[model samples]
Target: MVVCFVCGNMTAGSNVTQLFSRSQRTQQTPFFPFLEYHDPAPGASPMGDDWSVDACFVCDALLAQQWESFERGRMPIGKRLYWLKRPSGCEIRQPVSQIELEEILNEHSRGNLDDYSDDEGGKSPESKPQDPPDDTPRLICYSCGKSDKDCPSMCPVHCKPSYEQLRTGVPYYPTVLDTDKSPGSKVVCESITFLCIGCLPKFPPEWHAVQKDFLRQESTQSVLPRIPLPEVVSCYTCGTDVST
Candidate 1:
């Protein structure tokens, strides 16, 4: 019998059947575009079969530090507190109080809503003042000192037409191409903006590379493989195949 993660119950329901089927599908079947994680029905929290847990970079770092502390026999109080302070966005439970240690077998238990409310109400003594908003356009291309205006020719690198023009579908530049240039060989202005001389891409190359790597890692780590459906087999007592 398979166990449910959320309620810790042994269920012989279709949910467990479906989970095993999904696992088989991942191992044997081809990939489908539409397949994705489906949440349990409203008010019906399934056990170990459907739910999954994924860790972010911050959580992974915190876990590593905590593990080290465990090895040293000196529990890291700060690391534990950091996890308690934020939402994990996971179905897994977390220990909320010392009293739970006696009742719970797992290291992590479901966090108490009451504890969260108490933490929010208690304010730290060293809160900093909020900063005022800066009216100036925040984005400034390194190649050009001038702030990108809400115009077609604003950007030097990407030919991003003004946001207003894009939304309104109004032509910002009369024509993208210069009249003097040759027909086929001439540079055609698709959008009004001038190209950026230095770093024109939306983000710096290094930052983009880092972002892509992070996305790849996150996707691989977080995506759970689907199980395949069980084969239709006839019961020994009956001739007819049993439907799930």
Candidate 2:
């Protein structure tokens, strides 16, 4: 299902279409189609094979206005576009490909910075600021626009109150009892293994709640109690004494 990247509104079969400029002469294409364009990369080209469109017509218009301000020199190119939903912050709201930015940097590196120099034969005041590396990862949520740093410690979806919570004074707490705590409970490890948040699969709604509870409990139990081990016991069969 194609949903608006900004508002999450259903876009399938909607008359609304976002026009993406291909070139000065070429006509802008209706990019709201679900069959070919949706969930494109951070800076995917509109005419490329991997061209994906996430914003709906509404967002596209809003972005266009922002880009107009950018063009008017009223906004810095490096400044984050307020209406664009993508965290990459590479969206220029224009047809200009990201390669153009790279070429500007390349020319400057070759001591040909004069190529982009202003009319006074110096660096152009209108020259855009360089963007960050394309591979830089965004730490924002896919569903909500909030950054991971801004999001709550628990998953937002799982934290939503359910009907049961509304009916009763106590809220429901879910646990994934079927999930194994440890592959081998007897096994001990010196260090913890970690998985990237991106690598983790989309967990079920209850799983998130369970995970939150588990973490809370683990935090509480992190300080091991001062219980003493029992005194050494003797084995009756072999008459061997063992320490517990």
Candidate 3:
């Protein structure tokens, strides 16, 4: 039985003839009769009624190809079952042939493959080569350098010592640095530190919060307790100490 693609209804054979006639007459109009038609009842399968359904055979074939491609992957059994449910439409009177489907699939696949090949051809030298490693190491702040060891630091003004001091709790002055020194070389450096609390690129804001919380917890645990006094000694009148 042919299914009506538009309304997904089980159309009678007579209705199919009527629709075909209407479609032929309305060919010049902007509206496609198939898209406009809808089934009156919901959840009705279109297999029982024989009707000429309106559908783009090419589009249907492509959709089938897409489904087949995805099915080959490690999809869950439940998902595969769910996707197997056919559309609630009458069976297509003139469905797309396997030969036509194959032709369209090949054409599309070739175009896509060509596009991918072109993209790969346009890649930069760094992305293409997988051989010898570049020995150049990036210098970053001593505090932030532990995790992001290879990232270049914005600390051109201060050397490792100054950078360490600033991270340890010292307030940094941007204008006082003579030259920036690193694993590379020593050069005259301006000590301008613009630490953006909001625009941190390397570490996410949440990570910083987590790190701060950890540090606070560690500090609370590491604090030394004050020693208790054994006795109090005081003299009011003579200003001399007396043990009690």
- Reference-based TM-score of each model: 0.17, 0.26, 0.24
Candidate 1 local lDDT, 14-128, one digit each (tens)? 4342221112223432111101222232233442333232223343344446445553553322233222223233343344555543333222212222322235564544668
**What's the true lDDT of residue 158 in model 1?**
22
Against the reference, the lDDT scores of all candidates come to 0.35, 0.41, 0.36
The local distance difference test score of model 1 is 0.35
Question: After superposition, which runs of candidate 3 have C-alpha atoms over 4 Å from their true positions?
Answer: 1-131, 140-170, 173-189, 192-244
Q: Clashing residue pairs, candidate 2?
A: none
Tell me model 3's lDDT, rounded to 2 decimals: 0.36
lDDT of 2 at 16: 45
Q: What is the overall TM-score of model 3 with all chains considered together?
A: 0.24
Using TM-score, rank the candidates from best to worst: 2, 3, 1
In candidate 2, stretches whose alpha carbon ends up further than 4 angstroms from where it belongs are: 12-14, 19-50, 74-76, 84-118, 122-244
Q: Residue 101 lDDT in model 3?
A: 37
